[model samples]
Target: MLPRPSRLTLPSIARWARLNGSSSRAASGGVTLLPTQEPTPEANATLTEEEFSSMIIHGRSIYPPLYHPRTHSVPVAQLQFRAYQHQFLDLYMHFVGHAAAALGIPISRPVYLPTQRSLWTVPRGPFVHKKSQENFERKVHKRAIKAWDADPEVVDRWVRYITRHAMPGVGLRVTQWKRAPLGIGQQMVDSAVGQTRLGSGAVKVKALAEKIVQQELLVEENADTATR
Candidate 1:
């Protein structure tokens, strides 16, 4: 079967309602229908037929627009979901897409991975009845969602939201990439030096190094004096 048609936006729906003159005063207050002239019988019939056909073909429902990743070079978080049921996986992915949009995170289209199938066979009765066997198979469905140009905190929240409301039988895995400045290591070391825990250890190491250097210098001076 062909995939369901894309959903119509709110404005489109309101415009259609206005054109059909089915809009109520409370619902369409201040919103005006086009042409202001009465639509002819033939035109109205054709429009109604077309709208009915569209509703039937499109399943008579609407959804939010799909989000596109904002940046390709920036770091991103990849969320992978796995489930045994394909329908549930698709529904969960749609929910995730909506959530991502709500969080203002740019996301790419869900990439459907190849289905994995495994089969097992076991004897129905005893080993003597090996010829009579039962066969069982399992299929795993997978989908990948990539979100880009998202703040780290926002990504964390998104993950937490999904985790909190996760559906049963769905498995989620998240991989995040963090991009840091070139001198981050030095910055981390410098920052660690002033910390309560790392600072004491660093100070102790520095003192030990200085003491070793001083002892080596005295040993060299004594050798030089003996030579003199």
Candidate 2:
């Protein structure tokens, strides 16, 4: 007779059953088993100091340094953003400031203007129920951003960027003060005359005016000759 197989304990049988079930589950593509060992110090030490120091998270460098340059000026233009919701307006302003800083623009602290409030009262019921009415109020929030000693082209690009990605329910307005050199009027006139084209009809009208003036002058000359 063959020797009886060694009897397995209940705990051993249960453990064996669990191992078989896990293996089957893994083979069936239901789950995967991963190693639980942590990275060893030797593996970590393989990385150079610079390589480890330059690591980035979410596309931003870790512990980036900031550079501040001394300046002595204010911006020539002011960008103002307004919205009925103060929270959104403030959030967008912070975003703008961040963008400006990234672009190396010297920005000043945001100036907050007085909030504008308007109230309206309307009847809640029929016209006969004049005593029953409801009141509604709205407030407008405004923020002003100033940049100092920034290039106009750069400022324009910044404005375009902000406008293109402007948040919903927010309105943007730009105010620029430009200094004109002497003889600006003459320069403008010269530019208009040089660049503008007169239509055929306009040319004809101008010729007709000159012809009329010439005819009037000739008539006066003929009258004076006749009198002589």
Candidate 3:
């Protein structure tokens, strides 16, 4: 079956109501009877003809427009201000990342935010085994290269460049990530950082490596029991 017509937008509904000399509410419920149009037999199936006619008349009584009136206009100046704020925050985060990389410090270490009176630390979890760790790192490398396939670098070069530049830059700037555009900034940084809990891909692989050793120990114990 064909889809029913979508509800008209507020502007269209208002225009139709005005042209018909009826309130918007009325325009919604009032169906105009064309010259050859007859009430459907189904209308009388539920009630007597007179009763059906009355029901038709009642259904035609359009309700008032459910117009949501905004109290104040959004100032264009405020919007422009917000845009500028976003740009500044983005640049600042970039600068932070570059600085952190130069210092050779892990960005995830709890750094005291003097102004905020709190320390900021990145998230840390999602441990796996050593064999799993190698697979995980390989997967990350493949995915990252594929994602940036449009860029002007081969996979090895891209990985090297990211290790020397992008990763550290991202780690450094994360402290300021929250100040950037909430939606866009968070997504970009998260993509760069992998999971927020673990600082970077390297950390995630290390955690997975530890789990793999534990699994090996369990397998050795099971083998000894079977031999005995």
Best by lDDT: 1
TM-score of 1: 0.59
Candidate scoring better on TM-score of 1 and 3: 1
lDDT of 3 by residue, 1-228 (tens): 123222322223323333453553465576542323433434334343222212223222132211122233221110000112333434433333333333222222122222212234433434443233221111111000011111222223323443464322222211011123459977887777765555646777897999999999999999999999
Model 1 poorest 10 in a row by lDDT: 49-58
Order the candidates by lDDT, highest first — what do you get?
1, 2, 3
Better of 1 and 3 by lDDT: 1
What RMSD does each model have against the real structure? 9.0, 18.4, 29.2
What lDDT, from 0 to 1, does candidate 3 have?
A: 0.33
| lDDT scores of the candidates, listed in order | 0.72, 0.66, 0.33
Give candidate 3 regions above 4 Å deviation.
1-195, 201-205, 208-210, 221-228
Q: What TM-score, computed on C-alpha atoms, does each candidate reach?
A: 0.59, 0.52, 0.15
Report the Cα lDDT for residue 64, model 3. Answer: 21
Model 1 scores what on Cα lDDT? 0.72
For candidate 3, the per-residue lDDT at 151 reads 21
Residue 45: error of model 1 in Å?
32
